[model samples]
Target: MSILLKASDLKTPMSASDLFSRTGPLVFEVGFGDGRYLEHLASANPEWNLVGAEVSLGSVWRAYRRMNRSGIREVRLFKGNARFLVRDVFEEGSLDRVFVNFPDPWPRKKHLKNRLLQVPFFQILSSRLKPGGSLFLTTDHPEYFEFSVQQGQESLCFDVIQGPPPPATLETKYARKWRDQQKPIFHAEFRCHTVIPSAPRPISSIEMQHATLKGSLENVGPFTKQVRRFEGGHAFVMEAYRELDSQGLLFKVISEEQDFRQELLIQAWPKKDGVYVSLQPFGDPMTTKGVREAVLAVTDWLVSQGLELDQTWV
Candidate 1:
């Protein structure tokens, strides 16, 4: 069976020992495009546990099929942001090595901030690495490579070593394509020399228990779709759904912030004393600052419709 892991499969700030059920060397590959290198590493080193993180579902599926066919039981896949996975899931000083190959360069000057190898990323990577752990990166983009090197040096947690791309990493599709075109490939090995503590995660868990609101449920009509802009982010009521049994109303809320986003369902049910507004348990959405804002947005909308907001516990 495929060892592809969903977000819910992991606990916030998970440990490597818990994940593999044993303690051994652990390696991670960020942006495992096509999974060639990851597969090679897994097959080549059966003693070490391998974890692959990729955002593309198509690439994830392809990698999953390849690993399944090869009976590679040591490999696991995560489909989401690598930063979040590293910062929120992996324990400190847990990773033996990390590989990032051919990440998007985001060549435009205006989009440089979007690049993955910034100073903040280097700090987080350093904290996640073991005492002697190293990060191996290969890219055909010279500017990005140089930028990454500079960032690593500035972080003071790693000693950058410039070298030729590793043989296994060159097996990737992007590496082969770039090599075929005679483009110069840049490689860097950032050896972690010190530990850098990462900041606490903003959202601790994806599952929200409940929220209570003290307000009347009457006259809660005209729940049309609308968007509200707040100080740091925005919330949008994507749609409203009436319960088939006429018990309550479900509002689909989309919350957006600079670094976080989630689509949650907020339920407005009538309680004995007031309306109970809470996140629907079935959506399995992460409780974030934006999500809390979304709940407040719904409550404020209800108040605007004639209900008075006496209290809120979200």
Candidate 2:
């Protein structure tokens, strides 16, 4: 199998045992840039199964190439938010160690929310890690290091310890740059003291959603933007486009919830009887309430244009 894995390759709340061919210790690295460290880990511990998550497509490609060149087979890489993998996937207590090296500090006060090391994330990590599992983080930013330590403590799930980073960490690309610049490197180990309850907050319970309307698609033009607010989240229909080849319209929508956001497309195509409105599965969108609301927002917008709601499935 290819070392690189798409989001659809694994299910929500996936099992570590299912990821690897043989059972072994599970090591995860978040933001694995260039895949050097993960390569080192896999080489050094041949029995260990390594799983990495990276959001940057360039980084993922580079890592995949490096792994392929090294003939590494025990590593699986995911391209997406690490928070989603840790919180929604990776069965409870399946992780043995999580490495975070030189992650973006998001130094600006206004951008603090974008920083990955937050209290809620720590809590999620606590629940995912085994009894002795720990989060090892290394960074050159003093403010971010302190912020991470404080967040770990605030989660009340770990006993934080300041210490020297592993020797392998200094060999990474960013680590070498920081060392060359004579920047101070800080390392910490957030040892798990408590395992929070295993709760996977899935986006939605249903797999798919759709609606049928009793209206004509004729003159359903000049689509206006719409927004729908529901409990815990909101959906915004930013823009709509008409498909020239067929009598269909595509609406670009964004759905937002705490710590999760998705951009999706809702499609409205004419049927033999009426109009059909459903979420397009282009991005493998999770059917969250916000997403459902997005479909409703599009339907309501059509309703405003004189479409009657005949049947509902959302």
Q: Best candidate per TM-score, number? A: 2
What lDDT tens digits, residue by residue, belong to model 2 across residues 97-116? Answer: 99999999999999999999
Cα error of candidate 1 at position 165, Å = 1.1
Candidate 1 lDDT over residue span 194-229, tens digit each: 888884364544344345556655556767777878
Give the alpha-carbon lDDT of every model.
0.80, 0.87
Which residue pairs clash in candidate 2?
none
Q: What TM-score against the true fold does each predicted structure earn?
A: 0.82, 0.88
Clashes per candidate (backbone, < 3 Å): 1, 0
Over 4 Å off, model 2: 288-290
Worst lDDT run of 10 residues, candidate 2, spans 1-10
